[model samples]
Target chain A: MKVRVHVSLKNGVLDPQGRAIHHALEGLGFDGVNDVRAGRLIELDVADTIADEALDEMCRKLLANMVIENYRIEKVAA
Target chain B: MPFTAAVITFPGSNCDRDMAVAIEEISGGTVHRVWHGDAALPDGLDLIALPGGFSYGDYLRSGAMAARSPVMQAVVEQAGRGVPVLGVCNGFQVLTEAGLLPGALMRNAGIRFVCRDVKLKVENASSLFTSAYLPGQTITIPVAHHDGNYYADAETLDRLEGEGRVAFRYLEACNGSQRDIAGVLNEKGNVLGMMPHPERMIEPAHGGSDGRKLFESVLHGLNALA
Candidate 1:
């Protein structure tokens, strides 16, 4: 199974990289951008039998830092 | 027993030597260099020092990978027994990532790496690491890192503050750390994680000796216990 983990900073946490990207967009004459937030996408190739609980544990243990970030797991079409 | 300390060195740790040297010079202790792959710590260790560096290339997240290394397990277990742990710069990030400390270090608010001496006020002189400094005393220490901005929820922040676990606060705006916290102590006050590199400032040749007092303080506290 292919899994995608989307890791993003929590809403209330400040995102410096996101802010920098937003500024760059504005500098390039791009408009109508209200805000920008950065995130990481991690793809994993795992055995099809991997349980959701195992995936959740991976995120909680190593894939994401729960203190400042949140992660969502999605199954990708093989 | 002689003052003994172990400095855990992850693959990319650059400051482990500096930390060991600082402990040897100030604490006059036997410093052991422990590899991150080791499963156990030295016996009767007085201190466990995690040095600053881009461990595991700061991959995934700063200190995230290194935090889960084999050695950290032992460090965490020892810390639970009230062993004094000092984590500087990247070490601080590891402590938080390892769940040994609260909160997390984020990217600098300015979106640039900050590397320089910044003033810090000793928020809690009673900590095992800050006893050499007076409460509220402003001290200069060098901070060099990209992800030094500390973040925690309001409730955790309030609890840390209420319990006097905030050991050091940036006197001036250095990183966009919440509440200007530069260093924090674990609930047991046995672990301290700070962005500034006190080990780098232990000698006058390093430009200032303000960092020396921290090692002295820890050694003093441990000796007192002994």
Candidate 2:
């Protein structure tokens, strides 16, 4: 199985990188771009027997810092 | 009893030598250099230091990978048992990722790498690390990092303030840290994590020696407890 994790700063948390990109977009003459928040994508290759609980534990333990980030896991059948 | 300290060096840890030198010069103590791959810490360590540097090149996140390294497991265990731990800069990030400290370090609100001398106010002078400073005294220390802005929920922040767990606060707006928090201590007061490099300020030639008292306090505090 292959899993994908999308990790992003939690809502209401200040996203400096996102704000910088937003500024850059305006500098480039782009319009209507209200906001841009940056995030990361992590893909993992795991055995079929890997349980959902294990993946949750991975996110809670290491993949995502629960303090300011939230992680969403998606599994794709191989 | 002689002060025994260990400085854990992860890949890309540039400040390990500085941290070790600071501990040695200040306390005249034995400094042990431990590698991240080690499975266990040396027996009977009086202090464990996580120094500044872009550990693992700040991959994924600053100190994220290093916090999960093999030696960190032992570190977390030892810290739980009340062994004094001091984490500086990237080390502070690791402590948060390791769950030894609260909050997270995000990109600076200015979105630039801040590297210069900044004023800091000693908030808690009674902890093992800050006992040498007078409460509310302002000291000059240099901060160098991109992701040093601290963040925590309102409740936790309020509690940290109420309990005097906040060790240091930025006197000026250097980072967008919540409540200007630059340094904090663990619930047990044995672990300290701060963004500024106190080790860098031990010598007068470095501009100011305000940071020296932090190390001195910890050294004396530990010895006094012995």
Candidate 3:
């Protein structure tokens, strides 16, 4: 089994990298871009029998920092 | 009574020696060098410092690997027992990664490494780390890192400020830190995590010695406790 974790900075938090990217897009003549927020996608290969609780623990403990980022877990069948 | 301090050195910790020198010079006591692989720390430690640098080459996130090392387990236990722990730069990252401190340090908002002297306002003068400074006083300290931008949720930030847990705040915009937080103290006030390298500013030859007061303050606090 494989799992994917999507980590993103919470709303209302300043995302400088995202802002820079948005600026670049505007300079490139792309309009209608309201905002840009950068995030990370982490893929994990775990045991087939891994439980959802364990995966949640992994995200809470190491995969994502709850203070600045939020994470969502997605299970993908291998 | 001499102060006994330990400086933990992880593989890639470039500032461990500098931290030890500052502790020894300020406390006028024995400075023990502890390795990251050690499962236990020296007995009766008055202070434990985690110095800055790309610990574990900043793999899997800055300070993530080093934070899970055997030695950090001991450091956490010691900190829980009320021993003062100061984490600087990458050390600050390690403290947050190890769950000893609140919040995490992220990459600079500008996507460029920032290296220069930054003015910080002392917010809490009661912690073992910042007692030497007056509230609202600004002090200049050097910051050199790519991941010095601090981040925390709004509620957590509010709680930290309300509880007087915020130890230092940037006087000007140096990084994209939320609330301009440059440093913070743990709930117990015995642990501190900051991006500025106070250890680097302890010697006059380093351009300024304004940071010496931090070490002196911790030593005084420990001595009073003794």
Candidate 4:
């Protein structure tokens, strides 16, 4: 089994990198870009028998920082 | 008795020696160098410092890998026992990742690595780390890192401010830290995590010695306890 964790800064947290990207896009003459928030995607290849609780624990412990970021776990069949 | 301090060195810790030198100079004691792989800490440790650097090359996340090292387990236990722990720069990241401190340090708000002296307001002067300073006093310390922006939920921020857990706040806007927090103390006041390198500012040759007070404060607190 494979899992993908999408980690993102919570709403109201300032996203500096995302803001810079948004600025660059405007400089390139692109319009209608209201906002941009940056995040990370991590793919994990684990054993098939890993439980959901264990995966959630992994996210809570290492995959995402609960204080500032939230993580979503997506299981993809191999 | 001279203070007995330990400086934990992870593989990529570049500031461990600086931290040790500051502690030794301020406390007039020898600093024990502990490796990250060690499963136990030296007995009678008055203080344990996690120095700044790109631990584990900042892979996975800043301080993420080093936070899970064998030595950190011992550090956490020691912290729980009321031993003072100061985490600076990457060390701060490690503390938050290890669940020893609240909040996460994200990439700088400017998206560029910020390296310069930043003014910080001493919010709480009661912690072992900040006792030498006056409450609401402003001090200048150097901050150099890409991931120095601090973040926490609104409720956590309120709780920290209400409980007097916020140790330091940026006097000037430097990073995009929520509430302009440059440093914070744990609920017990024994553990502190901050992005500014107080160790770097301990020597006059390094520019200013304003940071010397932090080490002196911790040493004094520990001596009083002893």
Among the numbered candidates, top lDDT falls to 2
Best TM-score among the predictions, by candidate number: 1
- Candidate 4, residue B10: the lDDT equals 98
- Candidate 2: the clashing residue pairs are none
Could you give candidate 4's per-residue lDDT for residues B183-204 as a string of tens digits? 9999999999999999989777
Q: Write the per-residue lDDT of candidate 1 for residues B1-226, one digit (tens) a residue.
A: 8899999999899999989999998977699999999999998989999999999999999999999999998999999998899999999999999999999999999988999999999999988999999888888999999999999999999999999999999989987999999999999899999999998887779998999889989888977887
Which is superior by DockQ, 1 or 4? 1
Off by over 4 Å in 4: none
DockQ of 1: 0.96
Cα lDDT tens digits, model 2, B1-226, are 7889999999999999999999999999899999999999998899999999999999989999999999999999999899999999999999999999999999999999999999999999999999999989999999999999999999999999999999999989998999999999999999999999999999979988998999999987977887
lDDT of 3 by residue, B118-195 (tens): 999999988899888888888999999999889887888999999999999999888788899999999999999999
- Weakest lDDT window of 10 consecutive positions for candidate 1 chain B: B217-226
| Runs of candidate 1 exceeding 4 Å displacement | none
Which residue window of length 10 is worst by lDDT in model 3 chain B? B217-226
DockQ category of candidate 3:
medium
Candidate that would win on DockQ: 1
lDDT tens string, model 2, A3-64?
99999999999999999999999999999999999999999999999999999999998889
- Chain B TM-scores per candidate, in order, are 0.98, 0.99, 0.98, 0.98
Candidate 1 to truth, TM: 0.99
